[model samples]
Target: MNLLFSNDKRGDYPQSWYAASADLLAPFAPLGGVQRADVCVVGGGYTGLSAALHLAEAGLDVVLLEAHRVGFGASGRNGGQLGSGQRLDQLKLEKMLGAEDARRMWEFGEEAKALVRGLVERHGIDCHLRDGVGWAGSSAGSVAELHDYAAHMDARYGYGLEVLDREAFAALCRSPDFQGGVLDMGAAHLHPLRLALGLAEACVRAGVRIYERSHVHHIQHGSKVVVQTDAGRVEADHLILGCNGYLGGLDRKVAARVMPINNFIVATEPLGDRAAEVLTRDVALCDDRFVVNYWKLSDDKRLLFGGGESYGYRFPSDIRAVVRKPLAQIYPHLADVKLEYAWGGTLAITMKRLPHLARVAPNVLSASGYSGHGVGNAVQAGKLMAEAVRGQASGFDAFAALPTPAFPGGAGLRTPLLALAMSWFALRDKLGL
Candidate 1:
């Protein structure tokens, strides 16, 4: 089944809290007849919008196509946590890619966060950008590991983090379940949908043509690539696949490495007088679990809690119930609060939890599989892809050199196999392993 159309209505945004509050732009008409550009970007989320904006600013004729509205996918529906490092931890990356490359990767990750901040400031995009992200630990061992990692980051990378004991953590989070935590001042959170829509507005201002509700049917590869849509086609000197989890059968090589998965989130009704009881500060919190529970207070004093995962193609029917279990586990006092919104979105995951950036052809590039850390990395990937199209490919090449193995059993059986594996992991998480 096509992920883009399977779980959501065509050309319509999901009934998410993000959508409810966003200042959405007028819809861009679908592509018609024929079109040509110096670069054709498929997907209108962070990656594609950023790429199109940068490419157009460089004086390249750019066109970006989205099957739905901008930010209608995971970009708008995610937990909105802009994490500090790559998906994998530094020590693990050092072991996998060695010290020198790992150091470079760390710099890239820092640059990713800086890029997001700079873009927001330069473009005047007001998305309630706020600093501080706390990592809450589940067990004593996990707490100790997080404390050590915070020290490692400080000593090795000069990144400061405030380590919190159980008492201090509870004071801030008001959750007795957390053993300890660490707060990273460098990381931040924002209104994800507003950030995306702002970027789309900036892209349009920079002369990038955006087409919504234009689904790509196929791509004919050649020196000048031809991207086919239902009502029209785009012939371009360069093609970029930023479709992420919504990318169907556009490119077989990319499909093999980037697997789509569903994740859900729910928002509580506005808790005016009791907002401080849930979160003392307006910072985001994420726990150490295989299936993590992340939450933060919205600007309107509502708790935006994101949790639960479904291995299948579709989301659970009762998304609120799926998320409420974890929400209550952390904040039992707010267990019976009214849920105003519950929604799900698709995201791409890889075996190694690292992003996959590849040059499918000399003129065709693809980047996805950011795991859960796409807020920063995805935007950086877009800029790097734009650089590659502009004849400076060192950055893109560095990311492309990373390993991205295909899932076993190919396309048909990989989902079921992953489901079985995830069930075991979920059990381990439940058992406190």
Candidate 2:
């Protein structure tokens, strides 16, 4: 069961709404024979593409390899929410790494979001970049904590988020289940696949060589790294592993700390004027749950709802109905609506929920485990990795200092144990605990 080929075909993007809407580029030829570059990036998602773009812009020869098309994985099929701050809450980070370091991390998160915005504007990527993200709460206790956290962010980090009470949130979200929430104007949403495609085009314009269907099977490490694919090989001064959830068995250390999980999403038929019922504004809504329910209206007035999680590698048979169970909970009016498209994607997660950035070797670096906060973090990780290769390592150091532990049960049993733990949490979410 190779993740790259198990559920999908070679060179084919997932049948997602993002794929249908995005202006995809002609497929890049796969790597053949042998090649050499200053940097060889494995994986063509946001992280690898950004690294290739930055390194190329810095006048370094860069080569990027993807098993499938660019943005073929979670990069194209996610909820598309550009969240504020790191995957872990700021207060939790403050306790884990202390206030000074936590403040630095917060600034890094701000930099992450700003990097995405700057790239989109600078490259003229028309990904429907919209502002505002509503962090809704379902229970009264959760609502109070949301308010407290918003105030804490304002006082300590000067975040300045808008706190919405139950009534106010209902007026905007039109959800009966939401008790309250906080609206972060700093956060935003977009067409994820379009953004990825734009970044890929930018990489090409910057002189980076991109090869699709070039699956990297092994990496020979030494003074210089040689990344071996099925049909070709790439020897480079630096190697970057940006494969995220799809990185199976390539590196033991990363595979130990970062566990892959499957998530599903569904896009409803165009709602026309009814789009305003779910979202009065164009903002996205994501609830605070172990298995979160995230949704937003597409430009064509379709509701793109993402939910449901599977611990194993295989996606469920019916992804749309799995997501619909939760989608209807948030928008009951859409219970009987038609689903236009449904798809599933895999992403990496760490024990602490923070991204895992490590040197891996003297000249090799890897970053993954953004834990559903990949949109901003993955781009920043790539920039920082590129900076480290250029001899400035402060940004990478900040992330490398974060603690990421391996799963307790190791490779064989970790998935089952994680399934049990996630099931418990999901039960608690349903019980409103």
Candidate 3:
């Protein structure tokens, strides 16, 4: 089944805490007739919105189409952590691409964070943005690895992160399971949906024509690309594909290299003063599990936790129950805590875990496979694509330089193989291997 229409309504946002909390904009009219622009942006998540905003600010005619409301996908429904580096960390980059190129990649990570912060400030997007994301570990060995990684970043890249000892970490994260961790004050977290809506508003103010519920089904690529939706069509000098997990078969090359996966998150009932029992400080905590458990406290003092084990084509019947298993693992005291909202989202991942940025055609550019590091990377990818369209491609080139391989089993077999692999990783995580 087509993922876009598989599990959700055509033009509605998911029933997420974000959708409930965000002050959404009125729906933009769907595209109905032939349209032409300097740039055509498909998918209205961070990447498409950012690209449209940047291109429009530069005086280009831009049109953005979204099958659902803007930010209706993973952009609005993720863990909301603005991570420090790419999905693959710096040390791995050093080995894979050499020190010089790795350093450039590090700088790109810095730029990515800066761009998010800058946009929030410049556009006055009240996303509840805050600093300090903790990397907590359950075991002593895992904690040691965190400390070493922090020191390596500080000494080699001058990243200056705070290394917390067991007691010190316990002061920040009241969870008894965490022995120690590294706190990156440079990293931040916020309301993801608010950031996306803010970017969409910025795009409108910059003169972009945004058409909601405009599902693109086909394309005719040439000197000038033609993007066809059911109701209308767009012919533009350049095309930007930011569909991420929802891209489906629109482009087979992207579908080959970028595999889509679903993730779930849940928000607990307002904890009142008991929020301190979960997090002593207002920092986000992410564990070192292969499946990765992440959480933060919402402004209303609700525990927003993300983790689970559902590896099927469709989201599990009960998302809250799926995430509750891991949520209890981290905070057993709150095992039966009331979940106020629960939702699932899909995002793409590549073989190397780095984002896939490519010029599928000379005039058609695509970016996906953020691998859960999409907050900063997606925004940066959009800016890079915008710059590339204007003849400045160095920023985009850095990401495009990384290797992304096609799934070994192709479309049909990749999901089952991944499910088997994930089961193995989950077992290892449980055994603390």
Candidate 3 residues lying further than 4 Å off, grouped into runs, are none
Clash pairs, candidate 3, are: none
lDDT of model 3, residue 103? 89
True-vs-predicted CA distance for residue 133, candidate 3, Å: 0.6
lDDT of 1 by residue, 305-411 (tens): 99989876778889999999989988999977999999999999998989999999999999999899999999999999999999999999999999889999899
TM-score of each model, in listed order: 0.99, 0.99, 0.99
lDDT of 3 by residue, 107-130 (tens): 888889999999999999999999
TM-score of 1: 0.99
Q: Name the runs in model 1 displaced over 4 angstroms.
A: none
Q: Which residue pairs overlap in candidate 1's backbone?
A: none
Error of 3 at 167 (Å): 1.0
